[model samples]
Target: MLTDVKRTPGEKAFDWLNLIIVLVITFIILYPLVFVLFASMSDPRKMFDSPLLFWPKGFNLDSYVTVFENKDIWMGYGNTVLYTTVGTFINIMMTVFGAYPLSRKRFYGKGLFTFLFTFTMFFGGGLIPSYLVNQQLGIVNTMWVLVLPGAISAFNLIIMRTYFQTQIPLELEESAYVDGCNDYRLLYKIVLPLSTPIIAVMVLFYGVGHWNSYFEAMIYMSDRGQYPLQLILREILIKNEFKDMLGIAVDSQYADRMIVREGLKYAVVVVSSLPLLILYPLLSKFFEKGILVGAIKG
Candidate 1:
């Protein structure tokens, strides 16, 4: 049977305080998103006239229409989807392969390998050297440059290794070996099936990283056609904002162009963030379990 417990006066006071704090924080986080959404839909003239945006002043879909009609935006969307999908796959595979071996106690020179990997977390050869190295590898200005150079992340590798060590039992592996299972068979059949939480977490991590990445695309790609969605959006924002500041117009109608330009900023933010926002909810249950289990020991 369930019993009701009475709280002390101090406890009750603390609960109310906590609730107030949480509400404040929630408002802080949600206000910007709400403001952006309303502003994007509002008429630009009204938006400029009003400092506060509790609701749309005058509803319009022109911003969304303009954004959707751009050829560069569509092309960039396709390229971003491809890059994020392929890059995340490679990231997960490389992280798993690197982590599995390092997690094994019997692996030779594991300490040395771990040290070398960890060293990278604190230090690097810097951008110039990295760019030079990529140039030497004949990957510069190529799609491979985006994926290959960052295939493995040291922090993610450590997390995976820790998860494998803590969650996977050595006795299970021994039992599998006795049943004539090889290393590859044990990994694929036994280990991976039981690692759904960690895998899901890794997928979310790598996928979001690849999706939001603009710096890599900008640095590596010279071809505008090959640019990712973020890069293209950045270009559009800069072009529009610059044109507005300089009183230049692609069209003779200056007022309409400015309205579209202002609204496009918020529209771009929403569109770019939409994929991850949708994705996180689907993986949230696994994400919680994965982070807790993976972080518990290490």
Candidate 2:
């Protein structure tokens, strides 16, 4: 025991109470995830009867098999993967370039350009007008429609510009300029390497947005084959007995499958989320630093 800092009995009791409070809060947040995992594995009938139980009853792979067997589900997964990867790449590049010039005070037409971009953030053409634009552009009824229309999100551009303004030192650009490096060279060699965290943050943001999109697909596409994962998942969740809008009958087996499909919905949630969930821990290291680095002073 050191003479300098002995704790009184009351102080020790407070520490124990704080530890208990923290553990309770942790359990409150985590219990729902744990419950979902249990429900997904448990027999559906048993799950309904005792919905709050902690353990599976008569656990089986039937739900997993049922979800996997749905052809649209697999296709949706494939489509989502392609959309997230391609969309994230395009998002990152466009945001970086857009941010770069806007960060500079001397760029020609900077105010006009910035106002134009920011203006879209607060307003937009109505849905019908936007659809007409997409149709005119020939992106409707095509895979590119899913990937292109809203490619450069305005909030992301503003964040990226703000980041560049606050974080990249002016002296670094001046140093590169003295070496006769072009703008592209300075950006690729100096700015991008130091901007990994923000880039990763943008990737997560845009990638998830693309993954979850359904409304644009609903209005713009006529082909079932072109439906993205969320639309397909919507069919599984809510369209079990509903006729196709074009007057097609819902297959009878589709109704029979709902018992297992309920569980499969949870399984799909796990599957749809697996990539981001796995990537998050890896990306979160960059994510935290990114938000902090540029925002602290600004």
Candidate 3:
């Protein structure tokens, strides 16, 4: 049975204060997303006129239509899909392989290895040196540049190693060994079967990173044909290359490049972020448990 304890007047006041602060923070955080969504669907003229968008002042689908009809956006979307799929697969596989061994008590040089891995989380070869190395590797301007460098995130590796140690039963490993199961067999047939939650967490983490990444892609990938959706979106947003992207019809009331760009900007935000928003809810159930377990020890 659950019972509620009576609160003092001061405690009640603190609770109310906390609620107000949280509400204010929530509004601040959520307003931009809400405004962008409303502004994306709103008529460009009306969206421009309205300084505060509680909702769309005038409903319109022109921006969405313009976005959907663009060739570069479609090409970028295809490239982003390819990069995200392949990159996330590499991230999960590499993270799993790196972390699984570290989690085992019998692994040699774990202390030294763990120290080296953790050291990287704090320090790295600066951007110019990394770029030089990749240039020498001849992967610049290629899609592989996006996936290969960030294959194993040190922070995520530690979290997963902790999860494997804290969550998976040691007795299970011993039992598998007693049954003459090899390490690979035990991992494939036993450990992995029970690690769905952590794996789901890794997938979401890596998938979102790959989907939203642009800076590295912009630096490493110069070929326009190889650009990811985020890189294209960056060009559209920062360069205001709207005329080339949307090519708004002169006959339309909102054809003015300035007018179209406002709504178009929000639409691009929605399009770029839609996948991540959709992904979170699907993995929400696993995320809470997995992150907690993974982070508990490390």
> What is the C-alpha lDDT profile of model 2 across 166-279, one tens digit per residue?
889898899999999989999999999988888989988898898888888889879988788888877766775223211243577554554565677676666676777788
- Cα deviation of 193 in candidate 3 (Å)? 2.2
Q: Pick the candidate with the highest TM-score.
A: 1
Error of 3 at 234 (Å): 0.8
For model 3, the superposed segments whose C-alpha errors exceed 4 Å read 1-13, 246-255
User: Cα lDDT for residue 254, model 2?
Assistant: 53
User: What TM-score does candidate 3 reach?
Assistant: 0.92
For model 1, residues 1-298, the per-residue Cα lDDT tens digits are 9999999999999999999999999999999989988988888778889788999889987777767777777888999999999999999999999999999999999899999999999999999999999999999998899999999999988888999999999999999999999999999999999999999999999999888899988888999889999997787677553342224745677667666578878877777778898999999999988988887784
- lDDT (Cα) of model 1: 0.87
126-205: candidate 3 lDDT, tens digit per residue? 99999999999988899878999899999999989999999888898999999999988998898888888999999999
Worst 10 residues of 1 by lDDT: 241-250
TM-scores for all candidates: the values are: 0.93, 0.86, 0.92
- Cα displacement (Å) at residue 29, model 3: 1.2
Q: Is candidate 2 or candidate 3 better by lDDT?
A: 3
